[model samples]
Target: MPTPIPANARNPLRTFRFRIRMNTSAAGQYVAGVRTVSGLSVHVSPFEVWEGGNNLHRYAQPHKVNWEPIVMEQGLALDDTLERWALAVLEFARTGKAPGEAVKRDVFIDLWDGFAHPTEVPAPGPEARIRSFYVHNAWVSKYHALPKLDAMAGEVALLSLELTHEGWEPVPKPPASKPASPA
Candidate 1:
C-alpha cells in the first residue's frame, strides 16, 4: 500500500499570498492594500476551414488572440497611485491626445510559495517569489473611485480599476548557477 501524506504537509501556493506591482515608478512599487485581483485570462478564436473533397470534418486553427481586462480592487486609502493612473486615462479620452507614455504601464504580479521556506531561511522576499506574470502596455479602461455609501452599515470604502492590456505572459525563470569549485 502507498504511504499516505501527512496532514501537516505544506500545501500548494495560496492565491492570497500574491503581490501586484504596477511598475509605474522606477522602483516598481507594490500596489498597497490590494484586496482582490481578477481577469487574468487569454483566449484564442478558432478559424474553421472545410475541405471540398472530404465530408468527414472541418479543420480548426488558431486565430486572433485576446487578453481579458484585469480588474484590481482595494479599500480606499491615502495612496493615490490608482487614481492618478485613471485620471491620465481620462485626460487622454477627453483631450483626444495621447498622454505620452503615461497612459500605459507594464504591471507585474508575483506569486509566492508561503510554506516553502525552511525554519533556518530568512523571511520571504524576492527569493520566495515562485511565479510572476507580466502584463504589457496596460492602460486603465475603467475606474470606480467610490463605493455606494450607507449610514447604517460599517464597511471599508473600496475602489477598483480595470486595465486593458495587449497581453500577459509568464516571467521566465532565471538560469540556475553552477556550483563553484574549492580553491
Candidate 2:
C-alpha cells in the first residue's frame, strides 16, 4: 500500500515554465528575437581526492565544474543580425582577423507563470520573477543556418547556435529599496 501524502509537502511557489534571454558584451548588445534556447547543462568532474591505505573502497570527490555549450534555436527571419554575429565569431575561429569584434557574454534564463496577463519574463511583479539562472563568459561555438529542402521547403527556416560557456550560477534576489525621506 502507498503512504498518504502530507498537506505541507506541496509548495505553492513552484514553477515549471520559463523564457530565455541572451546578452553579450562582446557583441556590445543582446541577441534579439531568439525563439528558444537549449537549457542549462552543468557537470561536476568527479575524481578521487583521498586514497585508501590497503582498503577495498576508495573515497571520491568532485573537483572541477564543467558546463556544456547551450544551443540557441530561432526561426530564421529577414534580418541578418544574428548571422553577422555568428559570422564574426567564425572569422575569429578560422583566422586571426575578425570582421568585427567578438566578446564573451552572459546568458540568462528567467522563469515565468502561465497565468500572468503578459507572458514575458522580468515582469513588474515579483511573482513573475520566479528564478533566474545565468552563465558567465560565453561565446558562440558553432552556428548552423542550413536548410533541408525535401518537400519541406515550405517549412520555416531555423538557425541553431551552440554557445560555450564557463559556468552558471543562480542570480541572487535584489534587496528591497528603501523609501526616500521628505525633503
Candidate 3:
C-alpha cells in the first residue's frame, strides 16, 4: 500500500481555485453559445473535495472533473475541437491563463485519442462527450493562447479567458516550500 500523507501535510487544492466552461464549435459556435461557470469565492482543501473519499488529502491529485455535455450535432466535424476548446476556456476562467504550448493535433491525438473519441481526455461520466486531452492551466497557458470565447467562430478571434483559482488549495509551506506560489 502507498504511504499515507501525514495529518499535518499542506493541501495544494486548498490554495488554488477551479473554473470550468462550456462551448460549441460550428464555425461560429465556439465563441457564441458558450457559458462560464464561476467557482465558489473560497478556497477548498483536498480534504473538502474528496470529503467522503478515503486518503484524499494524502494524495495530491486533481479533483473529479465535472465534465459538460457536447453541444454540437452529429457529424459536426467541429464537435471534437469545440469541446476541447471549451474546456480550455473554462480552465482559463479559473486560472487566468490558457494552454499556450505550441502543439499539433497529431500529438494531442496520441495522448487522448483512446480516451474520448476524436481528441479530448477520457470523459469522467458516460454522458460526457470529449476526447481531447486537457493540460493543467499553467502548463497549457505557457504554450497555448486561448481563443476568443465570447464570440462565434468563422473568424479566428482570440478571447481572453477569465481565470480564477479560488477555492483551490496549495499545501502550506512548512519552512520548506514556504512562500508558496499564491494559487
- Cα RMSD of all models vs. native, in order, equals 4.0, 6.5, 20.9
* TM-score for each of the candidates: 0.81, 0.69, 0.17
Please name the candidate that would achieve the greatest TM-score relative to the true structure: 1
Model 1 over residues 1-183: C-alpha lDDT tens digits? 999987555554566767788776787887777888899999999999989999789999999998999999887874677888898899899998876448999999887665643443323455567788999999999899998889899988989999999999999856656689899
Instruction: Kindly list the per-residue Cα lDDT of model 2 for residues 1-183, writing each as its tens digit.
Output: 999866544333545455555564443344555666674878887786555465666677888887877887766774465677688787877886856545465667676544433333344554556677888877778889875756745777778888888888898766656689899
Off by over 4 Å in 3: 1-121, 126-155, 164-167, 170-183
* Top candidate by lDDT: 1
Residue 120 displacement in candidate 2 (angstroms): 7.1
Model 1, residue 114: distance off in Å is 1.9
Instruction: Give the alpha carbon lDDT tens digit for every residue of 147-171 in model 3.
Output: 4356555654333332222122232
- Superposed model 1: Cα runs more than 4 Å off: 1-10, 98-101, 115-125, 175-183
**Ten residues in sequence with the least summed lDDT for candidate 3:** 104-113
TM-score quality measure for candidate 1: 0.81
